[model samples]
Target: MTLLAPQPFRPKSAQLLSGLMFCWVLLSSAACQEDGASVNCTANPEQCGIDVEAVPARLYVDPPFGLGFGCVLMGCDEAKILTLENRGGGQLAITSVRFKEGSSEDFSFALYNDEEDPADEALEHPTIEKPLKIKDSRTKALSVTYKPTDGIADEAVLIIDAHDASLPYQDSVLTTVEVPLRSRVLGSVAFVPSTDTINFGYVAPDETGQAILTLENTSENDAVLTLAALNLTDENDAFAFTFPENPHANPGDVIEVALSFTPSEYQDYEGQLTVATNDTAQPLIAVDLRGTAFSEPGIRITPSVGQGIDFGAVRFGETDVWELQLYNAGGAPLTVTPSISALGDTDPNVFHMGSTSGEALAEIAPLESTVLSVYATPAGGGAQEGVLQLETTDPNNPLITVTLAVFGNAPMAEYSIEDIDFGNVVMGWQSDVVEVTIGNTGTGDLTIFSYDFEIGSSPQIMLGSAPDLPVKISPDDDPISFAFFLNGQSLGPANATFLLQTDAIDYSTARLDLTGQVVSCIDGCPVANGTPSCEAGYCAIGSCAEGYHDTNVAFADGCECQEERNGDDIGGNCSDKRDLGNLGDDCSDHAHSVTVTGNLHDAEDTDLYYVKMEDAGSVICDTFGDSFRAKVELISAPPGLALCVNIRASGSGCGGYTDYYDPSYCGQNSYSSNGSWSSDDDKEVVAWVVWKPDATPICTNYQIKFRADD
Candidate 1:
């Protein structure tokens, strides 16, 4: 059987359709051709229309790959149209059409008039009043609108029934056709979070980390997204997710969901979070949440808080050093800060102690240790106590303290002055009183049993004032004070002794010797190269002559350091550079100057000098002095021949020349290695004692030493 579609058919299909209709007519004429006489149905259908029950109308549908609304959002409308053609000779009446494919209300059908009925714009269900009518060789549009109500793949069978209305009830000539309808509906809007996956990074045990999941509606402004459900599945029970309270969201609206993760063990944990929303494209949003719980920092001290560092017996004025070990036993880095506690007044007998560990340590890697030194210096006797406190970033042991204990047991009397000299006194002249003090440098009390004085040749010196006959001195008590006087009555040198009898275990007596020259005060001090003055019945070198210093500060030693000025290199300018005579071939064959000790009063005190190298390939010099200052060796060229350039303008701590000096003060031409520049024009290299810019005093007290390297 050949079916001719009323749609836009191909030319070949139309030609084939005309041939089939002609063949059907010929077959009908041949059936009535008895006795060689043909009955034409066009003229008079005598036999063709004689008692015949023929099918007048038939239903035909071009599914065109089945009516389908691929995928659409819920509460949204998507429609498709199908052409129903009447291939029969009579008009086709589609009485009704229904959807039987998934029994889902999402898929529905309606009938609309063809181009012949332009006024039938409104969709109408196929029925007796608005039946889908397709005349012979005509077509009508059967519209199927899929308004998905659920988020699932669905299918529906469009059951269309058509028949000729003129036929009797028994011979209704009914036709039924099924067209497959398919569609998929999803949530009306979607949820976009701040992140698709939440990673808590490295979280330590017993620590909780949190992250936020943001929900945003990406649908039209009028469209709303309703959160249907939310859930989380965690096998380890280490994660907790909090769903947003408000379930409804519109376009441009944002929702936030909180999630927290806390791990009890040092292991990896993972969980899955599912959020159900009204997003047709993706109704369920699954996010992977992961985190790792690592071990925390732990501090272990060698001497625990209870057990302290004890120094058994330490004498006053003596120091004892101890060692402390700090260990980190956890998987993370630990930070430590150490401090010494101040001595408490409750204990009169206390020691002064401090830790070399200044303030804080940046970090200590896992399973590491560092050593700290603490020293205890006793200032009093008896049981001396101190504390060393350490603060660390360890959860288990944040603050750790170690105690220091020492005992002072012996007491020895110590005198402030071993001897007193009232030099050169006049007759009948009374000298100034010299105050003397006596202290105990031991653990116990020192008692002054008695006191005595021994005058040798002349009775010139005597006791001006003395402490009580018997006095007790404790290690912590203030030292007792007394006075001595020098009386000049004779003309000659005199000597005397003042002694204290104490109950000291080692020595029972403390003595102070006194001496003086009993001469005429009018004679004054015989100071060399300096003036003399008499004051307090004694002779003194009051002032020095010009260009001289009282270096020894004595009437006899006279004035020394007879330099013009304090500058080391007196001729310290470019015009008057100090020449450090030529050197020998050997490093120390005959050293012109082995070591020169000098102090740089200030940065401007620059000593510019040059040494002539003799029978030597190169000369290397080093500086040894105070570390605060930097010593610069400037290998200079005479005037501009061997230009001595202050590369870093002196005082610039460390630099190229200092690291390795080169004779090439001017830029090297061949760039042969570095700093070694020798001029055939001159042999003198000036070495300047300049300041290291920052630490000018670093090499202030420097011992400039030089030697021939080759």
Candidate 2:
């Protein structure tokens, strides 16, 4: 410092800074040493330098990413600056500078007398005329200044590449600058009750409740918030908002969304709230609310159609009620009105929960249930049908459906034939066959048990089949058919009667009346009803016709027989039937009758008697009177006409009679006489009638005439 060395401006400290000029000394030394002897500095390049080092270059930009600084509110301008410094002990060369659309423009830069200025054309660029000199301890800077195109978001990158001229060949160093975007601020908004789910206890129908929604701004930047809409899904309600700007929220501020639910008679409420904002990061925020608003106490009835209940078959003058329970699951009271409905028609005010005139049911509280009675009455025994429907309003899940059932009765079943007919049966034959068909038109089953008619008993009729039978049949099925056989003897159809009986009870009066007739005939000749033909012995009834006579001989045809017969006749109406005196009508010419009075002893010879006839050969009568031999006061005398008689018991001689006369009734009959005139010859009375001839007789008479013995 004592006087700057004028000797080439060299100082002793300059030798201490020799490392800083290492690159310059190597280049100068190589040229000086290569005059004749080669210093070989370029060959041994690593040993040619004095260890000179270059400072690292650094870049500075106005804003790191070139985001427009505060331009969103103040309308930014291009006031940013970019600089490059020579941190090394060498010069830096800037070969070219490039500019693009939306790039940092309207700017100028100077590097060692090299300058760049704005051009008239957009996206303009100019190559540098000289290398840039970024001296040590001196920084090179480029200035950029312009009015923003519009919003300043149409920004681009600025590239600055530097070359180090101290190296063998210049190497490039690249650095970039960016311009970012900015936004506006309106208000802040957020979900107050951040949770998405809400719960409300049981509420009655037509009841009102409030759902509160709170909003807050958690964003650091101010935001523009707007309440978009309060949307309801699957809801039935007419809603009004009380708070004006509730859904609109502000940043770092709290706002409330007043949710009002006014439900119809019996319903629940559900809705959603959406908030719109200007923040790009978060555009819209959504908040949903769900609550229950109770309705008035009114009957809400629902009827069902059970599968097993058939409506078309109900009884006449009958009513059926399917009770449906309506519950108030809201917080307020409710009212219910019950009614009946058909497909095309509805019955007004038929069923009432409380009052039929006014509101039927009322004051139904929370968690309370009531029954709605729906009456479906059938007017007559005819097929009828319909349904029942109830109308109500609910915000969410409003309409519920059920089925209705109605019914009527069908007609009763009748029969076609009441009685069974057993055509024709034989006699002494049992179990004859009969058939019948029973029909049913009713809805139920018809069971027939042991209902049959019985045939009465006769010698010609024998019942061999049971009169009881049973069968079961449904209405839709064909009529039950019964077939049976009877075996019995039959005179005629009229002679048999069917005794109708059921089970063991005897109801034999149900009978078919009949009569029988049997006639005899011989070779086409009619005989008496009960008599048989003489030779053929054949009899048949229901065959005889017109007048007929009886011929009592073989081959005797009554129509071809003679009309009269000649015979010896008795004077005063002698009948063809013979009559004896005491034998009454059964005697013939070979017939006789006898009466005797006598006293007989066993000690008499055999007697014989001869009959005196009015006609010589035809003896109409033969009998003997008693004879006596006795004296009163004088000596004994012989009998008048020693009467003897013999009796005949049978045959033509005896006239078919059994006589009681004794053997003494024969006259002029001797014990040993065999002559035709002797009493002994005709003394066969004892042999003819009396088996005991040796017995004593007290008196004698011809044919039992009394004879006294003295």
Candidate 3:
């Protein structure tokens, strides 16, 4: 083995000067060579040692740790580039790049001169055949490619030898540079929902309800999510969603969406809520949104007075009508069926449902009401009770019952007069008649038993005419009349009680008070001093005393002024008949005959006589003719009596009989035998006539005898 020595060190300027001195010494070396035969040899090997300094190469990696391929899905490729720069003034040569001990298969790397190629296959523990050299301040790229077969966290280390040379004789050890590489392999982009389905249990048709659905981003990194569409599968459009405007979320972030359900009908409804998103695993998510729409009906009764229907105090055979209100207080339409019936002894026909047909159905909308009419007509008197049943489609209460009641009574007789006043009457005179009317105001018929003055009453007041007793009066019919008269006999004030008895229970006895005063006549007759006499509540007088007449029919005015008659004998008797020449006397008594004389002035100037008969009887008349043709007429005879006979001749004739006669009552009393006469030129002839009776009695008759004059 040869011993190695270091080379001699010399300054550049000193080396040049040494070279010149060597040349000069060679030129003078021949002349001084004979004298320098004896030159000394003092050059020592230890003193001529050479000094040599060694510096190691430095490698600077832009990233001390390898670049990170953040995250990649399985079977997908991602890459990152790392730079190696030579910071020292020496060549940085990479001999081999190798993974660390615990490196992953999913993490790999590659080296390139100018650019990075991510698609290139990565090498593990790879040795460079030719050393890669890098200059100072220059960079070299190492591309890290990650292709994950499975989802897991992985790391690797890429070691670079900067001092390694291509020749085996060169130095192989230098500064070691390490670049750490890391990669995370993700499975896939996923969207996880908080709930898979939303259920809105029950909702009303008129109302709306809502629910919330959360969409969470299950991806490991931030992701841009897109809400492509939101759809409702309900045909009725009852379900919907309130979509978010920006549908972006980071890892573990959540996006909330609102789901609403609205119903329109009264039946059950079903629907689905669909959401479209950008998630790779689940692009379109369908959330089952279920809801049911239901209806509840309610019944209510509103009566006229109380909670129940009541027809109070109705008369028998009369009807009373009322109204009841039904309300729908729920969210849906209500159907109602109304019926009415008597509960106990009352008749079924008494209670009736009006405004609706038999068993008719009624529909009421939500929060609305309907009115039903009811009528109560009692057939008999007394208390009546009934029930009104209403059936509806309400879930809570299907059947509703209401009580009804009514009271009825018999017809009542109402009197128009509470009292009667005859006013003042003179002595020996009578007062005017006062009338009292009785009306049946109740629902039934009323019968009057009797109407008369009370027993043991004063003679001053008496009944004018007896009214027919046991008479029937119908409800709302014309009233019955009763009259009373006052006789001016008593002194001072005279009082009498007129009592009415009826069949009606409510009006068993009705009494009216008659009051009058006996007054002394002012202008009538002389007063009796010794023995004062009063007759019929009036002062005794022989005839009508003076100017005062009983105009008011009060006895106080004894002699009333003669009322103007106008040819109508309203209150006149036979003795006071008017128009004596042209008209005959009106008979006051059917049993008595009156003689009336009249002259026939012309053919049209005939006389007429009237007889009001109380019993069936014949009327006899005789006419004395003067100069004109006379005609005798007996009209309006009794049913069996013949009509009046008329005789006509040049002068006079008196033996004319009725052609048709059937006198069966008195066999010998023939109508022909009663009349026979002859006509005379200048003498007066007397004509006689008689009327017979019929089966039934007659009340009125008329007779006339006249002459036809030229």
Per-candidate TM-scores read 0.29, 0.24, 0.25
Please provide, for model 1 over 175-275, each residue's C-alpha lDDT reduced to its tens digit, 9 standing for 90 to 100: 67767777733335555777777877557888888998888877653455667787887787788977667666556777678899888997657689988
Comparing 1 and 2 by lDDT, which wins?
1
TM-score leader: 1
> Please, what are the lDDT tens digits per residue for candidate 2 over residues 267-340?
54545555444444555555544445443333333343333223444444456655667765465555544334
What's the best-to-worst order under TM-score? 1, 3, 2
Model 3 lDDT on a 0 to 1 scale: 0.55
Q: Which segments of candidate 3 are over 4 A away from where they belong?
A: 1-294, 304-307, 355-358, 414-532, 535-710
Supply candidate 3's per-residue lDDT for 146.
Answer: 84
Candidate 1's C-alpha runs over 4 A off are: 1-55, 70-76, 101-104, 115-124, 127-134, 147-154, 183-193, 196-212, 215-229, 233-272, 275-710
lDDT of each: 0.60, 0.37, 0.55
1-710: candidate 3 lDDT, tens digit per residue: 11112112222244544342211111111111122342211121112221111222346566564577765444457867777665433455777777778888887767766544435543333345567777644667777788754334567777766562323526465556667776743454567887776767568886898888888767766343445678887778888788876565545666788888888876655567788876767889887766656556655556433467778867666789887777665657788887777888888888887755347466886555688888888777667899887778988778777788887757688878799888777766888888878888775567787776788666788877655767888776898787788777756778888788886657588888888887766433343211223543444434442322232233333333332232232221223322222212221122222333322111111222323211111144224322223233433333443333332332342333222232431222111211122322221222222334333222223333333221
- Candidate 3 — worst ten consecutive residues by lDDT sum? 23-32
